[model samples]
Target: MALCEAEKTFVLHGVEENFRIDGREREDYRPMELETDIVSHAFGSARLRLANTDVLVAVKIEVDTPFPERPFEGKLEFFVDCSANATPDFEGRGGEGVAIEISNTLSAAYSSPNVFDLKKLCILKGKKCWKVYVDILLLECGGNLFDAVSLAVKAALWNTQVPLVKQIDIDGNNVEIKVSEELYDCRKLDVEKAPILVTVCKIGEHCIVDPNVAEEQCSVGSVVVAVSEDKFSTILQTGTGSLHMSTLVDCLQLGIKVAQRLDAALWDTLTLECYTCSTTEDESDTTCLDNPSGVVGGVTDCDKKYCIIVRVDYKDPRGKLASILRSCVDKPTYTNDVIEDETHRVYYRSCRTAKCNGGSGRSDSTSDDNGSLGDKSTIYCPGIGDGAVAVTVSFSILLFAYAFVRYVR
Candidate 1:
């Protein structure tokens, strides 16, 4: 449902209070998960899941004749595909409109020679040049698709492996090139200058970053700024409403500031050891599997520890699973029953068994005597059975004896 004027005003007030609809502050970004080199066939590939939005980018290189006008320059093309998985609305050519718009904007952003060093890809001037095809697949579009796509593209380019050129031979009307076959002999793209797009959505008197679909609908206008090294690579105004010149300028300044920081973080991640491609194919295939936590190697001692610190914000329901796992570590044996309250709140009542064998550290199992209920829901360990009940009864007797002694004293 679209937000009304009053609802939009409330959201604006929330932003003004430094709290967003999703409880994030103005400068805070949603949780993002990034994975690179997942596609085996592509020269470079990355998948980024920002909240609910999912974007996958793959880079493919093909040798082709350069344009006559710009013989020494290679080519970079952008293609965006809106997958059916994103939404039912985008099932059959439904997403083409947005796809074309995004692809066009990206092409324009990278068209400048300064943005990307296309000349370095030239093999033999006008005769032969490398054409890079950047294919973006939109798996989902909860919101902030543009920013997610841009980030994924930059990361994929950073992960790209370009074959080392050995020699180029030109015959009459034909040319041949030799690429080094050594596994370690490969070149990585210099993505230090890659652009990152930031979307500024203006809702009422406030501007927000990484707006969800509902927030986007509430926004009257938005500006997409692609910044590379504090420079404006592309500035695109989106949405139906108009913006004041003063507001637009302010948005541009904020966009540049955010992009610079984002770029720095991206570079830091890319330079880490985990981002580097493995020299051996077998090792490369196992890279992601080996590092389940996605900790990139070669990080400084301080940075390594920081990377391992998993922060769970209790306010987010998604964090409940982690909280539950942490609570179960010290208990030797535990049981839980799901109960629903009158207010419809559902939670678990967990019970832990007392120590058995007089603290001798022996493993014991437990049994339930609740007939059908016990049979359906109770969990018992091997060789425990009635032993746990006996142990509990003995412990109770000891506690009563201690209480009697204290009373007599």
Candidate 2:
């Protein structure tokens, strides 16, 4: 579908005015829908819909030998499949090129040790480890596919529950291992440093994030940046046009800023509490979202403000002490009225639990109970980012965020 000269001019004018065709700002993303644990057979799974683009990711684990050179580390593999249902052009082997590109991008993003700690998956020092297979299915291609796929992968990894190994026995060259039979006794992957991909498209003179298919087609050039922590793990350029060094730098900075906000929003969605609402038959018959307390299905109030603060104290064996404190608050609030609802899960393990404050205004502090800290070790579980919760309203459904934590020496 090609845009006419008038349509392209209109889009350029819209960008110049800082308003997009969908009325979104330069950095704004389309309404998104995310759901986790959808695949029962897979170890972990999540499905995400960003407007017309749809993505599904599943995680599978297998026992295998570790790499000879890096025996202590496990393996992570990514596989992408572009379904023909999305478009006839993707039928048979037509989509293979796109699938390979997406998969390679994912592999590059997760290639760094700081991004994902593979050592945690090691079952034995040199003999055995867990192989993680992340399979992605692309049901639709609206645009900004890279960003949508990365988000889905992160959500699926967050939902993954790796079984705990109870013990290991060795007889001759044979190695025997025992895994916990209890379903609840499992550990979660530490994805705090997992990378998120952001695609920044350069329009006439402006760089925009989350470009729709039409916007993508009109762009001169684009860059896909993989962000983890406060740095870029991988940066790949797409499209044919080239950018000046200054323009490239600006795009990198913009990508970082956009990725930070996106990361925060994702964490907020994953940590939001279940919002309960009541509705009558009449209310259901009419528009439920219009009423303040009615229903909106997955749409939520992005205007609602919230804040969260977390403090963690770590004491090493040498008596060195370190404290990590983080906090974030919704300052002015977003102008968007409706957003997709997303559910998140958390697990906590600690000797002394800290009380949390709620709502728009909150002031809380961590307990100074160092009495139990002298003789025993303590593990404190922290939320993904600043731990802020998103405000939500939905129709006819109640959802709760679950947290599970395990203690180990």
Candidate 3:
């Protein structure tokens, strides 16, 4: 979608006033919805919806021979596919250029060992190692592709569960490595210091962090800065326009600050998503969602961070609420009730295994009001079950009395 001069000016004026079209500040980002394990076939997968932009990333691990030059390190490759559904421009081979650009940018950003350690994926020094393939699918493009893609990739990696190596046997020229067969018995990637790419666009004299479709058209040039920890991992100049040396420095500074904020926010969101959804093989089991460390009901009262409960209404007269809940959440959940009032309703509570602090670090054994995990009892609403049982018993007694009276007569 092309923005006219008048529309561009409106966006520029809003930036100047620190109020965007969506009523967000210059540094503020649009509301984001993130879900992990969306792709059952893939080892680790995540879907991130950033306003109008939607991105899905899946991580697949394969065992392959390590490079002769870098015998100790594993391999990380990125492949991007821009679906035609996102835009007509991406039809057929039309999106190949954009896809290549995105893939190359991600490859460069993650090339540094400090950003992602490849040594951890090694099985046998030079013979065998895990090759991590990160496949990204661009479902929707609403501008700010670089930022959204990076965030989704990081979240997918965090949600990924790499199998643990139990035993390795090497006989003669043949070498064998045994990985743990248990589903949950896996190792988690240390993505605490993962790099986050932030795109800073030069609009007039000021620079903006996240530019919308209209705002992007008004930019003179844009710089994508990949921030890792306190330093910059890679800086790439995008768009056709040029930036002065001073302007470039200013852009880097803005990019770093914005990336920090973005990284923190991303971790908070990922943790929340992980906490609410259990990574259990049997998602239908309500017992897995129970947290032994906290009070009843998904969210606790003492917890300061607010929990967002999403209510979905489906148009199924037969009421397939259990299947719907299973499709959305991997955690075990019981249907609390089917409201017989104004509407046919099913209520589900978010499950949490451990306490999440909306930050990078999560407690290993702490439980809060949100619920707990690991052999904990599931959240049970006694009133609904008891009432149903009472009604059934009363009906059975009445039927028995009528049958006896008829027989006697």
User: Considering every candidate listed, which one attains the maximal TM-score?
Assistant: 3
Q: How many residue pairs clash in each candidate?
A: 0, 4, 5
lDDT of 1 by residue, 1-409 (tens): 4678888777888878878888876655677777777888999898888888889899999988999999998888999999889977798999999999899888877776678788988889889888889999999888988888998899888778888889988888789999999764677776667788889988777777888887888888999999988689899999999999999998898788767766655554443211111112223343322332242331121111001111112334422322111111111122332333332222222222221111101112211222221101111111112222211011112223323423573
* TM-scores for every candidate against the unseen true structure: 0.66, 0.68, 0.69
lDDT of 3 by residue, 1-409 (tens): 7888898888888888877777766666677777676787788787877778899999999999999999999998999999999888999999999899888989888888889898988899998999999999999998898888998899788878889999989998788989998765677787767788888998877888778888888999999999987789899999999999999999999888777777766655454322222213235554323441231232222111222222223335543322211111222223222323343343333334323312111122222443322111211111111221111001122223323423572
- Candidate 2 lDDT tens digits, 125-219: 88889999999999999988899999889878876889999999988888988999987577778776788899999999899989998888788
lDDT of each: 0.63, 0.66, 0.66
Give residue 342's lDDT in candidate 1 (0 to 100).
34
| Candidate achieving higher TM-score, 2 or 3 | 3
Worst 10 residues of 2 by lDDT: 400-409
